[model samples]
Target: MIEIKNLKKVYAGVTVVNVPHLEIKSGESIGLVGNNGAGKTTLFRMILDLIRPESGEVLSNGKNVSGAEEWKNYTASYLDEGFLIDYLTPEEYLYFIGGLHGRNKPQVDEYLASLTEFFNGEILKKGKYIRDLSKGNQCKVGVGACLLQRPQLLMLDEPFANIDPSTQFRLKNILKTENKNLGVTTIVSSHDLNHVTDVCERILLMEKGVIIKDIATSSSTLSELEEYFGVGQTTSTNTGIDNEENH
Candidate 1:
């Protein structure tokens, strides 16, 4: 389980994330939705201990994440290209990450085989470094590396962004399957209400750094989110980093 109590982050005295209390149980797939600057990325960074919180704490399965390394064993995240080793080829990068998780070359190879469709013939053996891949392809590598760890807790920020429409659908199915079969506790932040509602069992609405709504996935959930975001009247492409360009 993941726990948060009075968690907060500030930049120049302006609070970006402030959650009084929040709990995420095991095996739950959660989706976070909000406009740019709503604190989605900030909250994920704090949970991953990539950024130090100004107050309170984040607990992963009863282990405090801040200033600790124990939680990293069971947690994996892909927030941006910064997570990737830009100098290495896709194959090399995956093997390196797998080794850290105690997986050998053969094990990593088998796992990469399973993701062939996700790679869509562009990743493995491409003879290209991570920095050379297109933005969408780089997103694929980062996300694939995270899954290779088979973590207990997986966090992704705007994972669907930059990918083509077909791959987006594949990714949605893959994430849902991983969470269901592997019992991975997944947290994804996206602006696409349709995709988020389709994959997440729970949806969290954030505005100005506070969770304004939390509801189970249902026929009405998407509309509710659209209404809240005032997006029902307009078309929602849920397009790339544009969704959070300011963030």
Candidate 2:
């Protein structure tokens, strides 16, 4: 449901993102994996029109995202604390988000109830504002608000970071359910190879402003990714590069 053509973003003469062309079909789950300074977050910001691209356009359903509002109706993204209204309590923040989607108090309460297991009793009925919560708790509030929208396309950055291990497992299962059961298009950018591979059907490996590999996840995907990252190597002088030719 999304397409990119010659999408390139530059900063101070350095190309941070330079994908020539890419397409994501409806209901596809995509995992984006890369190292630090690999342009992953920059690309996400451009696609969401949070930043202007120096060249090319990102299209959602054939319409340029930067010039169109239709895509926002079905797209939800959470990249960082910048996406949260930290001054509001978790309940208030969630309620505000639900109301934006035309949900009433009762409807929102029901939705919150569904997230009980996901929240693990740490998110609701708290006396603190979202800003007072731990980083991981704030993240939960953000994701909860996004899910309350019942979006068709969802994007998250480093969703596995800063959360407890139990919460990570819960997040992975939630993503899988959203993708497979509800047919939502989910895109996750993370450094955690195993978690991303378990949740996404396809993986995109980006480095130095370029998408170097687009892989369809299979039984060996985790091992292959670890190898590419030099984690599987015995020598410390690894290049963190796969010798296989890029497709």
After TM-score superposition, the amount by which residue 148's alpha carbon in candidate 2 deviates from its true location, in angstroms, is 0.3
Candidate 1 global CA lDDT score: 0.88
Flag regions of model 1 displaced more than 4 Å.
Answer: 231-247
Residue 18's lDDT in candidate 2? 95
Candidate 1 Cα RMSD (Å): 3.6
Candidate 2 C-alpha error for residue 238, in Å: 17
Per-residue lDDT of model 2, residues 114-208, tens digit only: 88987989999978988899888888888989899999999998888878999999999999999999999999999889899999999999887
Question: Lowest lDDT 10-mer window, candidate 2?
Answer: 238-247
At residue 12, candidate 2 shows an lDDT of 71
lDDT of 1 by residue, 154-198 (tens): 999999988999899999989999899999999999978899999
The backbone clash count of each candidate, in order, is 0, 0
